[model samples]
Target: MKIDIVSVFPEYFDVLNLSLFGKAQAKGLVEVHAHNLRDWTHDVHHSVDDTPVGGGAGMVMKPEVWAECLDELLGLDSSTSESTTEVDDVSTDSTAAPVLIFPNPSAPLFTQRDATELSHADHLLFGCGRYEGYDARIPEYYRAQGVDVREYSIGDYVLNGGEVAVSVMLEAITRLLPGFMGNADSIVEESYTGANALLEHRQYTKPAQWRGISVPDVLLSGDHGKVDRFRRDEALARTNEIRPDLIERLDCASLDKADRKT
Candidate 1:
């Protein structure tokens, strides 16, 4: 997969080269490029923001700068802003058209399901807004041009800029790509994964007893069936107590008699 990230503080992503993500890049599982948004500016100061039109506290990122950067990255002609082609729905096929994403505080919350969906895209272009945020028309214009533009909020709170949000989202999305992890099954049963979207159950390592706290006896019994049942019940109870919203969104049809009782 190819990822293009535009940010004024491109150096912030240097950490991407130090972890499992670095390994993924080395293995050719993904490619990431961080571009300085100011590189697209033509002025002496290379300014990328301006005062808000209506009256705002902070400066808003200029749309023209973003447009030039995004146009080049997306391979779109700046002259064809009126393209009337229909935008395609997000698909799981890696050959699908590229996805344009902007991190917005007011947008729908980004979830693991979104991560799973985006992992299939062939290319992803992210525009990280600074100061007050980029002009809203940037995404609107792209959508009009038939781009599959997406705006997502990583959480309910606000941040100084989109760089951190993009980092969080990028890690979530890329780790799901094929060959990104050593154990594929580990991703399947993770919390907020699959259809359940429940919080993951607690885990314990060897030495069973730690700091006087003993691991669950079921885990040591060597009975896979009983162990699985114990973990399922624990997950159900934990999710109900910690994140009832996930339980409320659960599909009734997906729950079996055993799950229902739990």
Candidate 2:
């Protein structure tokens, strides 16, 4: 997979080159790059924002700079503002056109479902807005051209910019990519995975018992069936106490007799 992020503070993504992402890049499992949005500016100040037309408190990002940056990344002529712009023939596979993403607090909440869906994209282009936010026309123009433009918010709160949001989203998507992790089963069993979407059960290791604390007896019984049952019960209890919303969405068919009692 290829990911391109256009942000004024490109240096903020330096951390992407470390840890799992760094290893993914080294193993050729994924490719990630950050481009300075100002590179597309033609003015001396390299400004990417302007005062809002409606007298807003903060300046809005300039659509022109974003257009130029996107054009360059998508292999279109940056100087043209024509709405017919399309991603250059990416590959023989028609699905290779890059999917554009805009992160905003007002957008639909990003979830594991979104992460799983995005992990399959051929390429992902992120538009990180700052100050007041993105010009409404930016996404409008792209959508008008039939481009895949999606806006997502990580949570309910607001952030100073989309850079941190992008970083978070990137981590979620990257970890699910094939060969990114040593244990593929981790993805299948981890918290928030589709129908079984519940907080992972508490885990313990090492001496099992410490300072009068002991691991669940079921875990030490060498009985896989009993161990699995204990974990499911713990996970259900945890989810019920924390995020009952997730439990409410579970299918009726998935609720066993024991689970229904819970």
Candidate 3:
């Protein structure tokens, strides 16, 4: 998969080169490109933001800068002097144009399901905004141009900018890509995954007898069926205690007789 991140602070993404994603990039399973948003500016100052038109307290990112950056990345412009700044490694799959995502606090909640869906995309473009945010008209205009524009909010709170949000989103999405993890089974058993969307069961490792605590006998017995049942019960209990909202949304048919009786 190819992901393009356009942000004024492109250096912030240097952390991406540290873990699972770094290995994925080394193997050519993922290609992540971070470009400086200010490179698209037209003036000497290379300013990308301005005072809000309605006299707001914070500045709003200019739409023109975003447009130029996006157009260059999409390979829609010709006869441009900023050839050196153009994105040359973009995918040309032609099945679909890259999905443009703007992280904000007002959009629909981003779920693991969204991450799974995006992991299949050929390319994704993230526009990171600073100050207040990108001009509202930018997304609208992009939508009018047949681009699949989505605004996603990671959580209920606000951040100083979208750079951190993009980082959060990239980690979630990239790890789900095929061959990204050593154990594929770990994906299906994780929290917010599978049909029930239950939280993961608590896990314990070595030193099972530590401090008067012991690993469950069912887990040590090597009885696969009983172990599965124990883990499911623990996951259900944890979900009920913490995020009961997820349990409420589960399908009635998915619950077993024991679950229903409980």
Best by TM-score: 1
Report the lDDT of model 3 for residue 62. 94
Per candidate, the number of residue pairs that clash is 0, 0, 0
Q: List the residue pairs that clash in candidate 1.
A: none
On residues 94-125, what C-alpha lDDT tens digit does candidate 1 reach at each position?
75577999999989999888898888888899
lDDT of 2 by residue, 1-262 (tens): 8889999999999998899889988887777889999999999999999999979598999899999888778656655565654454243332566799999999999988888878778789999999989899999998887789999999988899999999999998888877888889637834466766888899999788899999989999999988988998998999999999988887677778888776
Residue 193 alpha-carbon offset, candidate 3, angstroms: 3.5
Ranking by TM-score: 1, 2, 3
Model 2 misplaced regions, further than 4 Å: 78-94, 189-191
Q: Which ten residues in a row have the lowest lDDT in candidate 3?
A: 86-95
What Cα-based lDDT does every candidate model obtain?
A: 0.87, 0.85, 0.83
